[model samples]
Target: MGTTARETDRERHDEVPVLEAFTRFLGLQRGLSPHTVRAYVTDVGQLLEHLGGDEDADPLARLDLTTLRAWLADQRRRGMSRATLARRTAAVRTFCTWAHRSGHLAQDVGARLRSPRPNRHLPTVLAVDDAAQLLAVAQDRAGDDDPVHLRDWAALELLYATGVRISELVGVDVPDLDAGERTVRVTGKGDKDRVVPFGVPARRALEAWLERGRPALAGPASARALFLGARGGRVDPRTIRGVVHRLTAVAGVPDLAPHGLRHSAATHLLAGGSDLRTVQEVLGHSSLATTQRYTHVTPERLLAAYTQAHPRA
Candidate 1:
């Protein structure tokens, strides 16, 4: 009895060993976040499934520019977004390079693969007055001294004050704060650490949370966590996002997630005369190019600068 073509294909495309090795490389060597490692592994798994091997050949050995293009085309046909396509292209290239270096393939076939540029849209940011109004609303809500309200208020304040990602913010521990200096030490992407300063308002909010709020919610599971869920475990990112959305709706401002607060902070910092390099450091962005996106100035500011500096204006 002969095997069916589908069974043969499945046998030739065994991805377990390759995926496990690549997972280790991505996590241990590349130091990618768990989420990122999962994404890369998923992309590579899809690629291998798309290009099954011959009877005696390794599946990855079949990887080539033509097959890579065909895979991307199939993804496009399935209505994948441009951003997803670009990320998958990058994943395949990285995987091929690793495969070659690890002796799984003769060469990095995906080295020549190119990704379509993803659309670049400016992030949503609040106006200065709107931000102040939003904070004021949050402050008013926290006046009741409710533990959850205090935590939410402090979280919002710290988010805008430091422009840290929601993940970084939730990952904060009690010891990460330098109360005297009004700074918080955050772990950013790729596990890089940086210290960012907060304003007096944020400091007051944090103090209230630490002194009055956290104690009320502390439990055996709380440990050193800076924020706690209703059940006293470390706060989740989705919870923080919910807090932002609910507060924004009550504040009558633009409905914003936590990242919107970050965008607003970065924009306000640039508008307030902070240098790009300083903003880059404050935000813990690995590249100055990422920080440069916040440099877009309002027409009023541009005109003011032109009028102030232009000789003929």
Candidate 2:
């Protein structure tokens, strides 16, 4: 159950003034988005509450490296995922650093606080043949003049071709595409814009959707959107997710989400000898580290390749 205002007040009453001030600093000074700021505040709130368990403790003054480590250990005991624990560690460290700099504490206790490295799980990706089969199924269903069928085919094709995120996919507008150049301009995280390329299959799918599919569903709410729902409005990510799930179900493959399509795209690109820097640009990743995670090949695959080709073996 969520805390009531009274419960929250009692839980955080001792640290309310400092927490409120830090939230303002995050918003006004650091310019963090409301969602991000809320996450940081919530993480910090948990830390503060943990420290406030002692009735007369000065939570701010007691914010030490020991307290920060204890908070992370407590989170681990709660069966939280390693990623969540890593984020909580970062949040608390950032909060403590800022508080110390602002004179809330005599020393920067978080300066030595280390966030745990998050576990890296290889993303679930479709093999090339599987991706081909998935798209083939969508295309088969799109053989008729149904706008819904056409949209599904194009959405899948574009997803696998460009490796764009779901938000970037659904946010595409008609003018975002350049048919002649076969590129789509996308706005990604951090409000960064880049144009990513697609292939002939995607081009054909996109053309068919725009010329036949989109127009049929184009209501006033569509507002120049590249993809439209049955109700003639811009397609929601939820609807796109349903389309992906339906496509995978029809293909008789493992349940694949939109992100799986993106993972497949990036993995295939790496397999095709695309350089990491080029792939990073294509995916609009601000950090190359993120792109590496999405496309890291297995050691087993490397060993298999060596055994097949090495003359000494």
Candidate 3:
């Protein structure tokens, strides 16, 4: 009739192992990236901590819609952004589904959970002429003698040319590039690899860096890294961002992040008549819907181009 000491000990012992098991399942079974798996574990860990990790109350047995909503509300009250709440909501939903499939729960309580949609903000991008002028200036600064300048030029060209994320850009190595074909093999999210091509300008910049620039900067730690920092180590994303910001300011445009170049590349591609699916593959977007955002940036440019060129008016 009464609660026993052995039952309480057993309940306490169950909580940690289940969470650890779920983590292993995420990495080994689901093939989730380390970053994504860590996020899921953190999201669920916070909820479990919120539920007080009761020794007598199992998380799977006690979890339900009400408690889930209460946790979300608490996070909101603590000033978590709607976007974060939405992400956490998705994470929990995924965890619940996984738990159900693993037989930890009799039902999927998160099937009906909901969170506020994050506002869709259009990405900042440069106009076509601004992008050209910025690169031109970078090219001028990249005069043959300076390895840093050469590296900067190649980085800027490759970024705008291929639209790879800063992380992917930094991760590139000498072996990744195909010189004659002018393509680079990039490993994107979930460790998926794809070959992306660049045009003549990017190829030339890369050649200059690889031939003249990289050799000058190469040190013990360089190890075939495509980009290098001041100390001859692999370049970091922050250094890349600083380069973009400084270049844009000199180009007489608003200081922009490296990602703004990516946005510019996507927008320019669409304005130049690239189809959506083609753009999607070039951007390495997993969803066609995610790639559709660039379509919004193209209509005004299209109308402007049409108005100037068409005789129908």
> After aligning candidate 1 to the native by TM-score, how far in Å is the CA of 280 from where it should be?
0.6
TM-score order of candidates, best first? 1, 3, 2
lDDT tens string, model 1, 1-313? 9999878866666788889999999999998877789999999888887776465566666778998999899889999999899999999999999999999888888899999887776667899998998889889999999999999999999999999989899999999999899999998888899999999999999999999899998899999999999888899899999989988889888988898899899889878878789999999989999888644666777788789999999
lDDT of 3 by residue, 120-183 (tens): 7666788888998899988989985599899999999999999888888999988999979999
Clashing pairs in 3: none
- Model 1 clash pairs are none
Name the top TM-score candidate.
1
* Lowest-sum lDDT 10-residue window in model 1: 52-61
What is the model-wide C-alpha lDDT for candidate 2? 0.85
What is the per-residue lDDT of model 2 for residues 177-288, given as tens digits with 9 covering 90 to 100?
A: 9989999999876557899999999999999998888888898888778988899988888999999999888897778889888888888887776878989999998789
At residue 71, candidate 2 shows an lDDT of 75
Worst 10 residues of 3 by lDDT: 293-302
TM-score of each: 0.90, 0.78, 0.83
Q: lDDT per model, in order? A: 0.89, 0.85, 0.86
Off by over 4 Å in 2: 1-42, 45-62, 98-108, 298-313
